[model samples]
Each structure stands twice: as structure tokens, then as C-alpha cells.
Target: MKVIQSFIVLVFGLTVLVTNAQNKIKIEYKPEHPLKEKIEGQSSLNFDFIIENQSKDSLKLTRLEVSLFDKQNKLIQQKFLDNNGTAPSINTIPNIQWNSVSTNLLFNPFPDVNSMTDKLEYTFTFNDSIEIKKVVIPGDYEQATDFILPLKNKILVYDGHDFYSHHRRFDYEFTPIKQLGFTGNFMRYAYDFVVLNPEGKRYLNNGKNDTDWFGFGTDVLAVADGEITAIEMNQKDDKTFDIPSLKDKPLALYGNYIVIKHGENIYSMYGHLKNQSAAGLKVGDKVKKGQKIALIGASGSSFFPHLHFEVRNSINHQAEGLPSYFKNYNLILGSAKKEGTTHTITTGDIIQSK
Candidate 1:
């Protein structure tokens, strides 16, 4: 299956400086495939572009410039990456080094930063062409963390017992009720293959039944320890259920939420809970494994009652998601054609709790 329509991976941690000799600024930007044309608002893509000076003499350059664009060669507006958009990284090393580095010689014409990888037929002004590169970086999954299951062993049962539940993101067609592009932007990935008792949807279908559906929504618990950093609870009436509006709004104050800094650069999100569920989850409040963080219900931005879950490197607070594997879980491969890299999972496997 074709995996990418386009990708603009804004990998952080590049060094930039300006040289006094030629009076040029050093630059670095995250590498992406270049076909991607959209800039998601409040997305988790941490863009780290830097400028620095690397000359035999110190440079007192007073001016800097930057621009962004999409694959259509259309200029893109990045409201966040301003001239002072970012700050210097804390240097534990005694020798200080700027975070941005430019390999191109000084006074070389600067890149538009907005141009996509596919659109570079020529460097419009220079004989040189533009090319973006990717660098390998270690992930923080190696860091210790914690998780709190809401329904306990019910939803994630097969995780320990079967392999079929190894599924991750589900391919979905847009529904009228969907709020974002891929439909709902909440936590569809977290619920992938985690068995949901159709009782919730069933109750909604029963003719004139007063019974509330069971799985429309539920309480989302922490998959690990962390303190609350940011929370967006308010939702719009027009947007599809379960999908919070892409734009920012007033905090609805649904119960509470805790963002524990499990390890370096890792954070988890649990949303759509009851009003009072966040009672014990104060900003600095500490919780343990299996400790109740919140209750399940259809509270904010939801159609049915269920939980939304995800894990990612939150150092810069971007939308990038990390693929996670729980300890002591089994898989049920959903094919007779199981072979190389085929994920095997079953329906009845009991995924033991951590």
C-alpha cells in the first residue's frame, strides 16, 4: 500500500550561524519528502530552523530572513516560526555551539524554506539546486514510562493473548461526522483493534430504547506517568463528534488531565472523560501505575463515550506520534499468508496487564 501522500518532517536540533567574513547566516531545517503541502495548526511537527555565524571574526549581523511554501509552489504562512520563533538549547557541554549550521558558502543566495522537494526544477536564481536531507536520531522509547488502563483488561485483552490486535492506525474513509482530514483527530490510533463491545453502537440503534449505548465513549487513562502541560477540552457543536476542532478555543475544564514527563521527550494524552474525573489530577499531582487518573464518559468533543490515547516525543509539543508496543502482549496475524514482517495476532489471547 502507498504509505505517504506527502511528508514534511520538521526534525528538531539543527545548528545555524552567520559568518562575519561574507556576512551570511547559517541555516538548518527538518527534512521532509517535499510533496506535503499542508501546515496543520497546533500540529506536533517540531520545526527547528537555526541561524549562526562561523567566521574567523565575530559577526554582528543585524538582519535575518525566512519563508515557507507548499508543494503547489504556493507560499505557506507559518505563524509560529518568527524571527525570534525559538530559543537557544541548554548546553550541558562547556564548549558552547550554535544549534544551526549552514554547509553552503557565505553570501550564497538563501533558500525560500517554503519550497517543496518536488517543485525544485531549478534554483530559480542560482546555478545551485536545493536539496533537503534527513538525519538519524535515537528515540526515547528506551526511557522508562507508565500507563493507566481505563477499562482494565477488557479493551486491550488480546494484546496479551492474541496477535491480531497488533494493528496500529486504521485506514479510514472520511465521514460527514468527521471533524478533521483523516476524519476525527482525537485518538482513532489508540483504539485500533482494541476490542470495543458493540453494545454502545447497538444501544444507539435499538428502536426507542432509553438505554445509553455502552462504547460510544469511555474514560482515557494514562499509559504512563507524566504531569499536565497542555490541555484543549472545549469543542464545537458543528464539528463532528469525537473530533475536537482543529483551532484553539477556551479550555472547557472537563474534569482534569495530568501530563507526566515519563522520560526524556515522551508524553501521553488521555481525553474525552467525565467532568469530575480530573478531581485528583491537579497540575503537579503525582500518580502511580494502575492509579485512577480519570473516569470514562462522553464529555468533551465526543459522539459516544470512549477514550483517546497516544504517545510521542513532546519536548517541543508537536503532533508526531511514536509507534509503541506494550510489555507482555501477544499477536494474532490476520492472514493465511503470514510471512516476513507479517504481524500475527489472535482474537482470544489474554493480554496481561503491566
Candidate 2:
């Protein structure tokens, strides 16, 4: 039977007998490349939906009102379906190719196709409550290494950026889930190798709290032996560090922050440290490499509790991320050896010291 006939029953408040009665809605989200960086930069207000009527009913959705909000509790915007189409309202899909260096985009003919097979995508805009995508200053980074920097802590490699998706970074995670790998959404860098959560829980999230994350303070650790370089301590929470919108935990946001220097060209950042950075920290204090510089706390501009660590090259207040590596380490990448030391390390390979 043609799928459109099923919709007649849907209007009468009757559950239409879907064509694939047993086939659940199969919808997948494929975030564009540079997922975190792009979303962080384009954090303007907008409404984006990718709904599929997988039941073979040729769904007709109208009056699509999507409630939108701002950092504040004010209702920011709303969206409604204007017309009826057999397919979801995606505009286009494009051929996306990624590598260590650059990304290339090739626009496909059709706008939308199932993620498993399609290229090209269409975008949608929201009501006037939106503006141009904001551009927060990019975070800092130092050059990564081609060598292996051995670490003592057990590692969990999060293949994607979502909930409970930590994989094994350095051999094992000490739990049954370690062997199971990840089972959550990976919006960006799906194939990229990232250090997993050390604490066995997510320390990072999009709530204004210090602990709403899926990978907090676990992997963003000290890169070298260094001292407390500079500490930006404050307890006056700028915004709710613990909420999603006005309705959720509405009283926590950007709780605390700190920065440390490792060497001439290497530095590290520990942001959203709760009140930790404020507790009698002084400049020029001597700190060992592995010593706990600051406790994990949700402090500033955080949607969750996690540490945001990065390596950079300057102390003039700003440094760009350069390629870098650790000393005396070998990586066992998925049962293979990608060995290096004192050079630069890309985000993969199980690492350890001899």
C-alpha cells in the first residue's frame, strides 16, 4: 500500500498501522566536521530538527512548534512546520572527507539521505529570535607529538563526544564496560582518538553545573612538571553553572577557572575548577608535574563538571596550539605499536611508560 493512505487514520487520533510495524524509527545524527569547535563558534540561536517517520506512513507534520530558549529563562524562539512533505525537511547532504590536515566538502544532488549512505545536507533557520552564529575566541592548543608520552593512570578512550562512550585509551578501563566499548552518540571526531575519562564517569556536559559532564577532569591533565603560573579565582558565579535553561537547575554556571604553565612553549588549562582555584593559590608557587594542581569543580562557563585542558606556546596571555608529544612513552594502538617519544602525538594509541 502507498504510505500516504495511513495518514488519514493519524488525524482521527488513531495510531496509524505503520507499514513497517516492527521497524522502529531509524534516525541518525551526523554532525559536521570539527564538531565541538564548530558548534562552539556557531552558538547562535537556531532550531534544527531531523525527524523521520520510519513507519512508512509518509508522515505529514505541521505546526512544528519547537520551543527555544536563551541562557536566560526568556522564551527565545519557536518554529512550525509550514508545509507537508513526504520526506523530512532536510535541505541537502554533502560529501564530507576528513583527515589529519584538511576537510573537503562536495555537495550532493539531493538534500537529505539516510546517514549510512548519503552525502550532502540542507540547513534550516529559525525565527527572528536568532542571530548570526557567535564566534567565541577559539581555545588554545600547543603542537601535538608524534612520540608517546607515557602516563601512569589507566585510560578510557572516548571515540565520540557523548554520554558513557569512553573506550580504552591505554589498554583497559577496569570495568566490564571497557570491553563493551561505547554505546552513545558520537557527534564529532567519531574516528578520532581522544583520551577517555579517568574517573569512569562523564565530567563534561552542557549544563551550567560543574559536574554535568560525561568526561570531567579525567584526561585533561598536566603535560609536564610545572608551577602554578597564574590563577584566575572568583566565586561570584557569572551565570548558573548548573542549569540547562530557566526551568532546569537555574543557579550554576562558569563556577571557577585556572591556568598553568609547563615550560617555555608548553602550558595547560584547567577551567571550571569550582572554588578550587580561589583557595589561596598564588603565582610562582612550585608545583610538581603530577601533583593535583586543582580539584575538579564546576566553575565557569561550563555546561557540566569537567576540566578543559590544552597545550599552548605563549604566556603573553595567549598561545596557539602547536603539535606536541610526550617523553618516554609507547602506544599500543588496538593491539599494534605506534611508538614515539619527545616528538608530537596525535590523539590515539594506548600510551604507557617503560
Query: Tens digit of lDDT per residue, candidate 1, span 92-200?
Result: 1112222333222111122223323222221111101112222212111222442334345344332221112222222112233222333212221233223344221
- Backbone clash total for model 1 is 64
lDDT per prediction?
Answer: 0.34, 0.35
- Candidate 2 residue 245 Cα shift, in angstroms, is 20
- Point out where model 2 deviates above 4 Å: 1-152, 156-221, 233-255, 263-266, 277-279, 315-318, 328-340, 348-354
User: 196-242, model 2: which lDDT tens digit per residue?
Assistant: 44444333554445345433333333455676665755543333443
| Candidate no. 2 TM-score | 0.35
